[model samples]
Target chain A: MSGSDASATTLGEASERETLKRIFPRLPESRSTIVGPGDDAAVLAAPDGRYVVTTDMMVHGPDFRWAWSAPYDLGWKAAATNLSDVAAMGAVPTALVVAIAAPASTPVSDLEELADGLRDGCAALAPGCGVVGGDLSVSDTFTIAVTAFGDLEGRAPVLRSGARVGDVVAVSGMLGAAATGLRLLFSEAVDAAGEPDRARFERVLAAHPETVTAQLRPRPPIADGPLAAQAGATAMLDLSDGLALDARRVAEASGVGIDLDPGLLGDDVEIALTGGEDHGLFAAFPAGAGLPGGFRAIGVVVPGAGVLVGGRPFDERGGWDPYIGWDGHGG
Target chain B: MSGSDASATTLGEASERETLKRIFPRLPESRSTIVGPGDDAAVLAAPDGRYVVTTDMMVHGPDFRWAWSAPYDLGWKAAATNLSDVAAMGAVPTALVVAIAAPASTPVSDLEELADGLRDGCAALAPGCGVVGGDLSVSDTFTIAVTAFGDLEGRAPVLRSGARVGDVVAVSGMLGAAATGLRLLFSEAVDAAGEPDRARFERVLAAHPETVTAQLRPRPPIADGPLAAQAGATAMLDLSDGLALDARRVAEASGVGIDLDPGLLGDDVEIALTGGEDHGLFAAFPAGAGLPGGFRAIGVVVPGAGVLVGGRPFDERGGWDPYIGWDGHGG
Candidate 1:
């Protein structure tokens, strides 16, 4: 493909404009963004009239290894990770800033491919939100940092706190795909060991295509966050940590108890409870309110002190913990 | 000092609370910011408007090193570096998002100290801005990336291509203190090769205290950028690359020549001509207009190519250049 072509042959085939086209339609409208994307600096209305912002860093070797992912995939994943934080707060994403550090020997084509992926990632979730400003520095290793902005749109922001007894619990995206994909990519089981051999790795990839994609490129449920807020979501958060752990955060924050139904989780119990990097919306709503579109009913708020799964304490064997590295049941 | 009490220090002090306080003043009065700095996510005014944004990264050992400065100094310098880019395009800085990556063994106090310095740096310039969100990740070394946002106040942004011949050149803020200070810091003439020579360094430090401070903490003339716009600056840019090199950018952008008067620079010849990191405003105004306050006549526009200093070609000498290492002068 030519340099400017929009083909998907090699990762470099896509251009920034092509990526933007794919992602822009998904974002909701917001008034605070006077000039959304495509500029030196984005102009926000700050109508409430203030702006809330934050940033996060992802380094290649420390954060992710190239052996398991491509540069474009890395770019998309990085953007999604930061944007998910913005979406978690019941806010509308407005703009994103990116800083990339890479070895000078890195191919310019790879850089362009990364930009294409970033444009696609942002547009897919926040439409019309382009990287407005950035700094490119040379380093020995590849590192990316993204700063994200959001607008509250005149509604009270739903925080980790505010979950209460009798509240219905819901989630707006899939679970465990990322963790499963990661295991397939990193585990020795896929390398030279295990009963099934290398062919099993291909079987895993074929069986869970969506899960593999989820690990490569997370799509933050940007629109559902605001919709949930409009539907009176009492408490909300992005499920970056496993559902069980993140739910514990909400329970602790609101000073309440959470009881999750393992039966409701279906056959993928481990994925539902301990899978992370879902970028899915997990929220608590008033009992009578209808669950918004795209959300699955998962559990209920209760008057207790901690998180429970199937009427038992959800321990590490059945949950996710960043420190211990997400070894749960069935994995 | 106690945390809350120390929070009162300016954002330049690099403390957590001060980061919030500095941003509080600049935020537009809006109800959307329900849970601002102290929360996991800040509520904002996203009222049907789109948002624009960008991000940049600075890595220690590559972008900077501790042997050259303190943690707080690094904090201040990092914030200033990104803020300059936002202000360069005639935008009002609003919010900042930061991500820091460091070794697991890195001291938490050092991180706090860095935060204090970042707070102080932002407060010194771009007051009323606050750090809204961030993520801390472990890496082999220290790195900081910042994403900054600005409001355009609904005007078409002034770009680099608006200059015309016969326009006069003006500058706001100092010229070369940073470059000079850097020279003093790394030279064997100022200190013995391996001895802990505080006294020797102090003499060098005292001789050009402003320059040393400028290198450690750059204060971009952000207010003057808008003033230049209002004063009808034909073309403008922040002096990041050395003046001569930066002049070439404006010249290439506008297709005009910049003729500088070295004799006009007062008492700091080396800094006036080749120094970098001044973060001063360099603008082109129509000839015969009285220059604005805080601005001084340094050059004039002509109808030709590139830049000239004292009727000769202006050789590029100072500024941060990637190829020649941090302290080397590049031609």
Candidate 2:
């Protein structure tokens, strides 16, 4: 994305200090930031005495593609995904620290757009949260690692191992949409490179803006984390590794089997069950306990092992692992 | 670096879960880690009510060369560099979260050795602090981003902006040795690819194991951070960007000029001024506040601007900036 100012400088033409000066004002400021960027270390007040911390990294090739996303969307997706991890623990995200490693040839304008997206993402979804610190370096490829800190507000962290046998399995927000969107993006990329499927692909891309956004920059139900905690969620996690893999994780951790109902999940049950990158919340509520608004019950916990479908293990597998990149081919 | 085990598997041959499982047992376990690696997010207890946070990343080509470093050294360096940041804040580090992005061609056993380095580094330096969580992904260039958390134990952080004009500036440990070692490594890399300079190069390399270690895997004086704070250091920071540049930072932050003494630092004063990556403690103490062990007085703060030697700015410069890799060339 180009700026309105003519003759924008690329990051290659600037000094390290100059690059930092240009990006400083673009980051959102947070109230919890007692000592923001430009210090030996940042001091943030943890009023509740305890905080939750999680970190994730996105690489250029394995995590995303420039053809599929703009610098802004990349920044937004990075922030949103890390935010979802914190919210999964029943906490309010307070601060973010990002480390960006990019090739020197990258345009400085792109970094500015990335900064704007980071600020905008927090403002639109997790307000009051801001980027507190950053470290930049040169690398052969671009990679962003983000660590998010959140306040639990005296509540116990909702762990993945807290589910009981009688808990009702549910999900919050969109599911499988990101995976579907990813498939279309891959198809579009292939189409652009080879034979033209422009008309059909255009209809697919133009008709599903939400799906495109989901695959590119997902806005998970951040608020539902606290609501689930308040409603006594027995177990909780973000559906990043697809429902099947992540459900099995919670089950193994909590020592219970997840009995998923394909019929109850409506028509997109296949995607909901196996598609990853949804960034939606996966939680368990006691059998009779009330679920927060926007939550849909899709399964239940039973005394057994692994994730189940139709009261038995599925013959088909659903999930995306990084070893196999976007093409489902080994790296 | 390849492992001693001949049958070691490359990461391309393993799944993400399998890769993680192979490395999990090698990480050191921390008592503060209520939940360790393997979950969606590891849960850590912040018993002191507040924590000090800092992050740093090391890229392969720009930060270090595999020719000069082993996988063990790479892991150790990554952990040491970040631990130094937490200690710079006068906080004892408690936990570490690392996200590693590497190519598929990297060996799984190399990662295991990397994990061993991580655990050993923490055990040898910041005892009781251990690796808590990790996020693994595929990338073209291998990068390790480490975020370290520390407990302040109720003392207000000693910021870089707290130095007074009358304060005495002191530093702990060696300076410039790492830079000198880096030059040697570069020459060696160039020599290996070009004409031979074997005799002299071998002598230069073999004569300075400490310097080589400083460049490839530095174990800085981490304990000096709290010792400085206990000695009533008013302003503090670690020397990563050379003495001149970093001194200017503290000077600008505290609004005070610094007058350094070349003679006071003894014979290695030139290296002391321009050499960085020493990871030594640079602290400003109220004049005659009784300096701690190993910390030598090197300069004094004065009312002016920037850094000065003999009341004049030095003609030489030494430092590392990402935009310009080792040669300080932008892009």
Candidate 3:
């Protein structure tokens, strides 16, 4: 790239229209878009007479660090996380409207890469799903807020309150990998003084690609969400805040209890039980109903009020909570 | 409220769930909400088989100042701005998904008041439209990102590119009050050092309630949007970035020129022509079609490429461009 190109130019030096002109070409238009970006709002087809919507925010420091996450990774993770929520509702994501607020000194190229990542993430995870519209603003802190829309295709939404006692508890997608990746970044990817070092971070990522990738750019089982719902999932939710805490939420919402089998979760049972940000689908199905192809039975619903591990109560809330969990560390 | 209540507690001192518990009661449920908050995603009805979607971001610095606006005003303006975009598309807003990222030190009661503002903004401007879902996170910059969904009720969306050479230009709602209010804020509602002063802002606001309220908590004519479309408006857009710049946008999009009659605008024609953030509906109607009730004719469309005032080409682009206009001052 030349000195005047996007890589060298900061957003502060560019007009909002000029920046948008650069981004519009990289973004993919959704199949359902009647009128895409550039207008006041994008018009999208809601073929089933109803749509599922979800919004999520990822802010610097509490959500991710510039030392660890690339602009592309941030965009991909934003798309993946919101798409997972739509899937948890048994809906196919149709469109996304993303609003990014970054420091004016941010490179215009960074936003271009983010747009590419959003396009690629949608194309890979949910074909035909694309970014239909978005907004940009200057802020002191970088924040990405995404609202995803999903098509239910005439199916009734599978809610978290539907799980019944005697239903088999199951999950799709890796559970412990993302949390393990975060631990690796914090422990092995930092310098001697506990700051993130690019060299050390790259070394750790190279050594544990799967676990680290799970943290940086997760590929949730988006398709399996609708499949589980189609197969009569009684209740479902995205396992964003660790299996233990999220399962307890389902139990509490459903007026039932869940009993998990540690042996079913991989070799690192503790990590699988308490780790979060996997964005996997956790669901309940009738005992006789066959579980979906990607899902494996990990537990059973029981008559009670909370979660259980081998018939004993597991009450420790081991999941991410921004206010309580973030240590005020940027890197 | 007691100190132990939301008034004194900061977000960092409360869990995400605890904060949500306090906010949920203050929010109103949309009439079309199939599933509201607490679910992984919200389900909303799209009775017209299509939806108009838009997203807008307001960061603390370029958008508002703490000295001038309360949390309630921020929330109300956020809703009003996004709702106006939906209305400009000739659609009735059905739902809103708001994402707020604020500093951890922000008091919880500020957020509760913000939620009340969102509720009331919806109730007063567009009845039956409510906050269907939202996300919250911790950030150094207070940012509000809102995604609005609107139902067309089967009418074709009025696009900015639909204007013809002979159309009459019209506007609904106050023109220069918001920008005039902002000018007053910048010039008089600040201390000698050019910093916003709370007491000075309140004094200025009390002296000019209509103008200051136009800036702090805009009440855009949301109902006029659908009415214009029903009455045969050719092109429409929300007058967000001043009459001159936004009209130029419509003119350029439509391959025509708009000529405004300064006599029709109120006194202070420069402010009326160049002021922004009123979020009013600006539209073009056939000369033969009777203008909508709230709308008043202000100009005429002519064959050309930009905006004009009294047959003279108005070349200066006067509008709020965060990147180019903000002086990097938060307050």
Q: State which candidate has the highest TM-score.
A: 3
Sorted by TM-score (best first), the order is 3, 2, 1
Candidate 3 residue-wise lDDT, A178-280, digit = tens: 9999999999999898887778999999999999999999999999989998999999999999999999899989999999998899999889999999899
lDDT of each: 0.67, 0.82, 0.92
Q: How well is each residue in B174-216 modelled by candidate 1, as lDDT tens digits? A: 7876777766766732334443244665676677778778877
- Per-residue lDDT of A1-331 in model 2, one digit per residue for the tens? 3545523765666677888888889988876887778887888878877777899999987787675678898889989999899899988888889999987877877888899889988988789899988899888678999998888887888999999988999999788889889777666644544432435545666878878779887898888988888889989999997888889889999999999998876578788788899899999999999999668898999998899987988645578778864332211
Candidates arranged by DockQ, highest first: 3, 2, 1
Would you estimate the TM-scores of all the predictions? 0.80, 0.94, 0.98
Alpha carbon deviation, residue B56, candidate 3 (Å)? 0.8
Q: What DockQ results do all the predictions give, each relative to the true complex?
A: 0.30, 0.60, 0.88
RMSD of 2: 3.3
What are the runs in model 2 whose C-alpha is more than 4 Å off?
A: A1-7, A192-204, A325-331, B1-7, B192-204, B315-317, B325-331
1 or 2, greater by DockQ: 2
Q: How many pairs of residues collide in each model?
A: 36, 1, 0
lDDT of model 2, residue B238:
83
Model 3, DockQ value?
Answer: 0.88
Best by lDDT: 3
* Superposition error at B54 for model 1 (Å): 5.1
